[model samples]
Target: MKINHVAGARRLAIPLAIAALTLGACGGSSDGGGDSSDSSSDPSKFSINLDDCNDPDSATAPIKGTFDVGYSAPLSGPVAGAVELATAGYDARIAAENAKGGIDGVKVKVTYKDDAFQPDKAKANGTEFIESQKVDALATFGTGPLSAMVDDQNAACTPMLYPSSSTDAYVDVKQFPWTTTILPLAKNEAKFLVNLIKDRFPDGAKIGIAENQTASGKVQSEAFQAAAKAADLKITEVASDADPVAAATTLKAKGVEVVYHGGVTGTCGAFDTARGRIGYEPKLVLKPSNCVNAVEYVAAGKAADGVELGAFGKDPNAPENKDDAGVKEYLAQMKEAGVPDDVIGNAVAVSGWTQADLLINTLKQAASSDDGLTRLSVMEAAREQDYASPMLINGIKWFSQPDLLTGIDGFRPIKWNAADKRFVPAGDVISIRP
Candidate 1:
């Protein structure tokens, strides 16, 4: 994925984009109170009209034998290192599930493809999976690629299960009834950050946000700004790609007491390093969940120390979690799958494992339901999920409703201990109950 490196002037367009993507059809209430209507009791209400697709039967058809799934990920791109681990985790989980006789005695088979994190390639892969291959469902990683193919998935009425994206597009159940994601919503993340800032600085502190230029980055930045405005917290904004040293000086001069970077890994490291070099110490330095990797933060050295991260899963590599049964089982499974020891605890890999587990559980529910293991039943089961996975943080449940698009609405805040080169619990899990 190439960095956009857009100018600060581009910030003006973000609010408009947010209005279209966030406030229009794709997002929930700005107050964080999700749709209260209970529509899950009737599965028929969730069914889509598939008259326009090439083969609508694929969406309504039942499996006679094997349950086929088509998945695509960035297996050969700049993000491949982390994404491939997600693929490995997915493969390992599928293997484990098969050994246990699969979902309701029907073996689950996944056809994997490498999208290379390209939108066009991902769209092609999605079309092939739904129109040609006629797979039962679709799953993939990356927000851009998923956004590219979402229309096709909805058109075919194929269940697009557990796509790894933070974009608000997946949450518009009425617009894209076939799609749902396991990733936390950027809006929710913004709300969480705002609440944290208020709690840490009740007297109020000057805030600054280093906004990334990508579409997803813009969404996050706008979300935080919106939440902050709602809470009466003012924020100064900076482009994430700005000269880090200059950016640090400007922020310090502006009396910014807290700095939040909702961007990619490289920029996060650069900004942290610059702040350290310039001796600009903000009261709080925060990063998104995706930037929690040790290797990515290593370039920032001690500058990365004390940086807080928002995450949903327990870090398997953290020494404190070494005794966790879920962490132990994850390690054992990765080892069993012949994964390199060094790659065992990668966060993206853990997410892949988490997504696959969700898929397996949903399939089991669909298989046992009165509707039987058809595409409609699978989607119905997915929309009504309310369970806890071993891999997620304790007491943090994964759930969904017909109108609630996000599976997890909270994060477990962790801080990077640069000296220890691992993440440790910063505070209790913070969530917004809808």
Candidate 2:
């Protein structure tokens, strides 16, 4: 695995390329005079013969169709704020692409439904996308919801593009051919986090981990234990629960010098609150997930100030990224979509935006056919590309290989500036090879 600064122009031709793709692959005559057989074979000449509804207000009227992709995520719940921000990224990217004339010639529309982070709801939404919406594909945030709907997705053969889960089981290529997890696995991420801690702190420094009791959290804890053993760092405390403040307090009592949080954004807030209460601040290291809603931690005031976080791309709120082409475009698009600057800065939003970016790029490659693209073709195309998303950190590109299930293997570390409500570069992007 190799990591470098993400440096490149925002890909401008993706929309144009998708629009320019026609039925030329069908061998239709270039000249006005064409063979009857060739003319009949042209897919462009065929009309979409959808039946019309008699009721004017029925809303089932026949109209020109656009490319429909389904997105199911928790819109309202404990993690609602984070989920909304992630969807905002998806919305911003879709608006930008549409303004550029959409994917090829068809405008892309996301049929969104809130799953409320429930597995059953996610499965139901998956069925709707397959049976009713007849979507070309599906995209989601979080691994649990994605895992819940995997069987349905596989049965329907509708590609599940980018689910925001770093769980290894969710990304098993052989088991879930219809699914693709874009981000690095949590285990790999844990290794990177440990490496950063070891490099920054002394070998004998007391380190602590605060995480949820969920499956992903357990995996993260296990990975941390292994990495800690290799790094020769002492793990003084381990906390698992909804509230991370208790864990923080325990670590503080043990005189832990550093703390790494492997839980939700709100848990980060809990840590901040606990630290504020105890008036003890250890060097806090958070994963990118915690940084997604930095403002949440901001409410805890200086407790979370100067916290360092991991990053797979340029920090969305970093002032230094203001001039970056990709950052400029993202900000502009997010603004146009009416997303507030604060929410746009969420790291989760960056995740959703990059996911859509990768899917579109892969679609462009897969849709180069006489009959247009299918879900299968898109999945196949995805496996073929070494994808470089504009939202990724400078110098690193996600490459899908034959033997590897995960596409990303590196990330940079970032620090949160409470005064500016932004994340600035804390260190260079580093690769974590398996």
Candidate 3:
């Protein structure tokens, strides 16, 4: 319910102090030893006894072992498009990891059930994940309509589930223990929008927020409003219409200068037309969710222009992503596997992949010791530190966010160039150094 932009470095970082991250707690050593010479001196270290595949001395092994991760998403529901995109991202990520010899040479087992984009299903899957499958932890579990399962995850005492949903309430780590987000927090995006508006628009500029009536959209709208007010900007109105483009046209006619909208890719495109219709140009800030692939949002040439959006996560097309540790490799694997590269890049798949990536690392750490290889160990690993994925916000490394109850709420403020059909970071995000 809030949209504004501000710039600053990350204030809090995961305590990297030795005390905060106990060497034996996760059973792995974060400190890099002197050299391979010393490791070779103890031939026993080469016996392939540890869980960390990061061991450079030996060849990464294949999936001789088995562990499970679960997913809760809408395979059938209204937001199925978004859910599908995320699922594809997950599958591609899995295929890539498996192709390169799974974590610790053990293949990861991903099991999933569709929540039909329904909350009941999400809750149900959460229970199953914690009790039955006994997975190391949940990964990229789409909240769908579930809002969240922080209490459920905590009640089940599960480890962090790298979540893709963005509910600002979960920013607090003290509450939710079993999930992390990849996108910059929605509140942060809102804050970012504020700065953008002040710098772009002049005095007496009318700003309005038109968002989908969903809880997420409403939350974004409010956050935008609060930030706008803090910056001494005036909000023209808040419209609950389900259609963004139509609503955008009406709001523009009402003399709106900046429009903040929370809608799907389709609705956001309509906002583009609203600008031309009114003959008055207004800066448009879209919810980060709509900032992704223009394949859908900007279908026709020149349909979407001057659209300011909030990206809740990484830009799939960033050049820096080329050198990302595993990106090229993932793309190669997907290509060889005959899976559509686009499928792998889909939002759902990205969330799934993000979830899988963090879980794999946690599993390695949890399995470090012979005695503590239970779900509890994995849970602890999820809590101990943040997972820095290649596609996360600039400064923020996502661990299990305890706030939003689910893994949603991770987002960044990004802008879209209708000409290029790409997402670029609109402003700086505050977080730890990668």
Candidate 4:
């Protein structure tokens, strides 16, 4: 999970500092000229007019300058395995895009920061990118960190896209017009999980739910309850941040036939360990948030066997996807980027690639539009584009549906095979409505 900044990072940092200083010279003087409600206090002071594509050539004219983007995620934390793999995915995707002469000739430059999964740090990083760096858009990971940056996003008027959080709050079309998600909503995931459970355990299995004590976790908790009720499953108990062993023991004693873990992947690991120790193996279904292809978790030896995981993309190691063009490209890019083999299957890495794919495609659409290169135009393009990538689920297309702000509506079911050390498709891609 070590990042090799050495000289490449320094080269990127210098230009960003210079650009921020140059942009700031005109940004602060808007005290008298513009409306206070807009993201930019003084839109009139922009160095380059975003309304007109400076290139008079054509709709597909090569862009004249660099397209600035910001990225913030946990690079050092409990979820670093996921974050770091995702970060590499972003880098690999960007490299592929840039190699193709970039989007409409404007090379994208990302100012990446590590938020350490801290709310305050996430906000600070978001502020620095939007206000100081003056980036066109910001990409974030995780619900907690994304929530922390909402105010910063509105203030800067910079569009924030591809937040991996499935929380409904992130998709408020009215409140956060500048924000949209790339993943399915948590409630939608809940519905899909419940459907699977109903079909598998037709007799109405007794279920126990466990979640974190955080705000996002609470939202997931409620979604699970509603879904469980819809499926007519009996609820034995619900625990928040309780000792995994104790909780598992209680649920086992109560004859709970299944356990739904609604927290981080670590929580899932804890529950599995507890279940193994107690010799009670119930059907474990994880919310998409906790469902991932973490290397260590996969290597844990039978802890995750038969554990059903919901995700929006194909497994990196899936035999069917191995020869697919997109998966091959992704693997090649990761190898070229020096991504470690052990961390390649992390699900967040797929998310990172999806994020990059959306960003590049949206920028291309915006750059080629009648109203070109403006932040507003980019947001509009993001909302309008029916983007798809090689790595997304077989039938899923990014923003394929017009009504959904979060482009993805479906997820595939994957099961961990501890003996084989890989994830195999558990079922077909399942789409759920909001």
Sort order, TM-score high to low: 1, 4, 2, 3
On lDDT, the stronger of 3 and 4 is 4
* lDDT per residue (tens digit) for residues 168-188 in model 1: 866766577678887778778
Residue-wise lDDT of candidate 4 within 1-434, one digit each (tens)?
11111121111000111223224332233344364322134332222122222221222223357877788877788777666767788888888788789877778888889987788888999888866776777877777888999866854557787776768876644345468776677787888888888888777777888766655567778888888888777678886645877876787788777777776643446666666778877766455544575564555467668777677776687778777888887888878878877666667677787788888888887777665676655665765655568888778777632223646767778777778876677888776533
Total clashing pairs in model 2: 12
Model 1 CA lDDT for position 396:
78
The digit string of per-residue lDDT tens for model 2 on 90-188 reads 878988888898767767788889987787888899889888887777877666788888887765667788777777775544445567777677777
Which of the two, 1 or 3, has more TM-score?
1
What does each candidate score in C-alpha RMSD?
Answer: 9.8, 11.4, 11.4, 10.8
**Lowest summed lDDT window (length 10), candidate 1:** 4-13
Better of 1 and 4 by TM-score: 1
Alpha-carbon TM-score of each model against the true structure: 0.84, 0.79, 0.71, 0.81
lDDT of 4 at 88: 81
Q: Report, for all candidates in order, the number of backbone clashes.
A: 0, 12, 60, 1
TM-score computed on alpha carbons, candidate 1: 0.84
Misplaced by over 4 Å in model 1 are 1-47, 50-54, 242-253, 265-268
